[model samples]
Target: MSDIIVFGIDFTSAPSARKPIRVAAGVRQGAVTRLNGLMALPSLDAFSDWLAQPGPWVAGFDLPFGLPRELVEHLGWPTDYAALMAHYAALSRAEIRDLFAAFCDARPAGGKFAHRACDGPAGASPSMKWVNPPVAWMLHAGVPRLIAAGVHLASLLPGDESRVALEAYPGLLARELIARRSYKSDTKAAQTPERLIARKDIVDALEQGRTRLGLRLKLSHAQRDELVADASGDSLDAVLAMLQAAWAASRPRYGWPDAVDPLEGWIASA
Candidate 1:
């Protein structure tokens, strides 16, 4: 497992200079995963290019790889996973928002957002949600590019085995350490000392091998400082994702669940 590049991507539905797609690149050697560096892809094109790169690399992307199976069934879309993605990729974002909003409107308040099987375990937002976290848009914006880039979408759409893409939620690991203390804010006004402390706690936990992933995060002092300093938490989220990738790569089945629902891709190590 040593020297295989592991990438963690904190993706954005709309990438730009202000909020570029953040990537944390590293490699796993035994139980310690070392941070190589970080980079930002400012456009979808750049992200696409990144995906097409030659790999013996495995990645955990902070985006939904599939929509809810219930939602797909309700819409009478393709039941097959690959076909469902294609049908989904053809729709406009506005079309998606409208459909999802209508679905919510017809359902009871508590039962509005239909979820994938992995959502509850991962503590992830619904893949069909178009507001707040807007992960539906993420699925739209990110997954198609992964498809066109010809990378394997582990369990959902197979491509290059060496270039694997796994769904990952940083919150899954963060909550393990900090218990839902908010550690990031896109708004500077909301980036409080409390959040900074929370970020530090997360970093410490990863460095100390406190999480259930069982792999320690190896960071230079400067790298540790860099992860903590970014109040937006994008960098740390990317690293957290990388940790998930590292955990998967260290194990059999790429750390995915046994018999994953093709319509609802599993989050690595969830």
Candidate 2:
């Protein structure tokens, strides 16, 4: 395997050893990418420490790296990507909630969010949402760590060349393989056989190289079984993100569009 590594992060804001950030790590070898390991960062602090380590690696993190441009401009936060993140990093979560709530209240009912161009295609949640996926919190909890670690966030900002971060959304890939099909649930009571079958279908398609990105997933028998058995789909999402990381590694500009807004970064494989 090459010294260069790849990672996919399934993040949690309130992390612990019991429910830490799930990471899928792997290496790309020619046409096949082998998923070599799965691990966790027990807390956000632990996650930060890991990012600070020196390495030549590319990672696809399942979190929004920026906010809506309109929102930023409206709030008069820094328009520069790095400056905006710095400003965002300094805010308390409660302050974020209050500010974003007022912004939404000023907008029409059906159009509460100011979206980046990629969101519609990527089918991602608004980075400002505080509930459900809580991606705003994901941005709050995750991006600052990336910035603090001094890693290059591909199109967003330049930092360490070896340690590159790209935003990834596994749901984008999963939906391509199985449209609008629910594959996994965080709640044990909600994990159904239908989702299980959908997960299997997605796995089968990836192995067959059926997706547009055109990279085959290589997994051991046990790894395959373990991914398939996770009712929460966290493991599967990590793998999907790993595949996106693999794709990003193989492309120019990390597969981002040529004209992405600097303040509103692009999502990998969106």
Candidate 3:
């Protein structure tokens, strides 16, 4: 009877029909129940619509929320969320590439950009950083939808207790299970039998409730097969994030407050 709905999002900016957003749902019993198979959402609009539906829900988004404080402050960008979103959205991908390249040009050869303290501890790349993954654009594309849907960010303490959003890093959970075994194969060519076995191992552990976080992943047989079959871990990543959100949801003290430093930002595990 817990009214909280849990969603785990596997996000992408250029998602297509074949690899749309993957979402997993869980409901609270004494422990969490993995209600059904993961759902594939076509776009942010569809995601927003789903979020706006009746019922209190908490979502674990697999994208970064804010940029590193150092980068934002150094670049003299607007710090407010609304202004930041506008500034971010207005820039084209090419512009972003150029700006980031220029920023790197100003730094020492080895050190390109300043990183937040949390980045090292949480093992997350800086949102504004463009090198390994363009996480900044990921934040740009993803956070607005959460805002539009009126979800409360766990990092930004909201007045409403019903709807909650938490920034979740799927890597943290994946590392716990596999210890750097490369369980998720993003490239289709890299998908192998061993990777599939790793996915199954992780899935089995979750279904059996084998984490210190105190929640069990409930999935139907078909759901289990789908999750294991996804060598890319897109679906599995969403499910991992969902569990992180569920763990945060169980702890009321972890609610996000408004004073978060946009530059330093916040990390889910940190």
Candidate 4:
């Protein structure tokens, strides 16, 4: 086993005791990636502390690290990505909603939300969307903490060398294995047997190294069952992120294209 700690973080806009941020911690060796541990950060403070922990580690976070270039340009926000993040972090959620809404209001129909370039290939939610996934708020909440943690944001922000953070979308990897089958939900009523089965299928595929990522997941029977039993699927999502982190560790620029938009960060392995 290598000393390089790899992580997959399933982030939330609002972390709380009821639905804490979920994380999967692992280490990769050759073609096998082993689950090292799992954690929950019930508050942003806890998550910030986790981000500040000493590393020799790299993490995959399931959140957009930047806004749409078009939106940023139209809003006349700072062109530099770090400056833009700082500007964005200063606003309240209400202000964010209002400004983004106004941007959409001025745009023509069917193009209400402007998206980052990587969003198209990753099938990700628009970073500007305040509803549904509320990823815009996620960017507001999560990105600033990353900035404060001083962790290097792979191709985007340069900070601590030992701790590298990459933007990851578990859906990008999950769909490669299971297509569009639903695997998880937050509501009790939406957590069906079919979803449970789908989660199991994903786990099985990872263990068998069936996906194009070429990294097999290593988990004890108890760990495997625990991942399968989490009806909310946060754990599974974390594991998916972990796999992506593992894939990115030794790659040049963490597998991102050389021409990634500095204003809009690229998703790892997309």
Candidate 5:
């Protein structure tokens, strides 16, 4: 059997005191084993510590690593990976807000930012965009750590096959199965019993490997209950993202390739 550890990462937009990063792990033996607990790391440093643990592992992180090539060219930001990370990290939220605001201010109300071609295909939020989801900053906050961790980015085409990283969008998988139904809810107030049931329904389907994608989730009963209990879905979301990562890891060709085109994106469907 291949030794594999999968990490599912649920990313944050503006990581505040309330919402930190949530990560879940799934170990694969002859079968998949969903670990008992999830890890909630407070800061990037803590996350780095977790990543540095001794092991060959694959991670599915739910954040954009690259922006649209068009957006980068228009902004005239450094295209090199190292330079881009530095440039992005140096800017504060306020600065990012101002820049995006200016861009929006200049454009007509209908079209604020120029979206990449991949955006339609991938159903991805614009990497240069800064509003609603603030995915650009999610990339800003999330990607640097992956780079620092030295994991093999699917897009980078790195030679090291042990430490694999893939760009996973859990919503894509969720929408495929559930369609328009709301299966997972992150809002505290919206987390009613009905939503909890929905989460369970989704989990049951995943365990049974009922989707078009032929992957089964091996989870313990206790783990399932815990996943459904957490209204925030920090753990469940991470697991979903991790599963996507695992799916990507299994396939070399589909792994996010290093390319510039924000328009090329994927999204979850109902």
Candidate 6:
């Protein structure tokens, strides 16, 4: 059996004890991926420690790994992926907001944000957006930790070969099963019956192997209940990400395409 554990991370830029980063852990055997556990990282330090653990694992992290190549060029940031990450990590959130806002101000209306190549196909937000999902902050928070932990980011950077991290987005997979249907929401008021039904539909589809990835999600009875009960959707997103990681593990280059821009790293299964 392969010793590689698969992990899916639902990341938060500023994790607290109340709103910690959520992770779904699992392992694959043949065509089925069995979810093993869920984790809540109380802080960035805990997340860092988890990544630094000694193991051979492939992780699908729900965080943007790179900015749009066009944005980087326009801002005169280093073209080198590693260097750009270094420069980015050094800035405060306020600085990032100011810089990005300035960039947007210069652009024409209706297209304020620069996007990575994979964004169009994945139907994802631009990595530069700081509000709503705050993916930009997620990138700021997550990438540096991956770098410090020495995890190889497929085409983006080579680090700890055993601990390979790929950019994963749960929406990319969820959309495949349920087109634009809202599933889970963080707010209690927004967790409608329709969203609950959507979550169940998504779970059912996964169990039926209804995705292009062709991997069945195996869950215990208790696990299924736990997944359906979480109105926040964090746990479900992690599982979705784990499925992506499992799929990537089965293919070469961690399932990254040949044309993926190294500077603008591609999302796994995008």
Worst 10 residues of 1 by lDDT: 250-259
lDDT of 4: 0.92
Which runs in model 4 stand beyond 4 Å of their true positions? 1-3
TM, every model: 0.98, 0.96, 0.88, 0.98, 0.84, 0.97
Question: lDDT by residue for model 4 over 163-182, one digit each (tens)?
Answer: 99999999999999889999
Q: Ten-residue segment with the worst summed lDDT in candidate 3? A: 255-264
lDDT, residue 145, candidate 6: 90
Where does model 2 exceed 4 Å of error?
1-4
Arranged by lDDT with the best first, the candidates are 4, 1, 6, 2, 3, 5
lDDT of 6 by residue, 1-270 (tens): 563589999999999987889999999887889899998999999999999887688999999999999999998999998999999999999999999999999999999999999999888899999999799999999999999889898888899888889999999999999999999887889999998889889999999889999889989888898888888888899999999999998788877788988999888887
For residues 25-122, what per-residue lDDT tens digits would candidate 3 score against the true structure? 87757686565557888876777777776657777888887766667677788877657766877888788878777888998987886676667766
- Write candidate 2's Cα lDDT for 109-159 as tens digits: 999988888899899988888888788988998999999889998878899
In model 6, what lDDT does residue 35 have? 93
Task: Indicate whether candidate 1 or candidate 2 has the larger TM-score.
Answer: 1
Task: Give each prediction's root-mean-square deviation over alpha carbons.
Answer: 0.9, 1.5, 2.6, 1.1, 3.3, 1.1
Of candidate 4, the 10-residue stretch with the lowest lDDT total is: 1-10
Question: How many clashing residue pairs appear in each of the predictions shown?
Answer: 0, 0, 9, 0, 18, 0
* Tens-digit per-residue lDDT, 93-203, candidate 5: 788778767776888987877675556655666777776667888877777777777766654435345777667677667666676567656576788887777778778
Question: Which scores greater on TM-score, model 2 or model 5?
Answer: 2
- Clash pairs (backbone) in predicted model 2: none
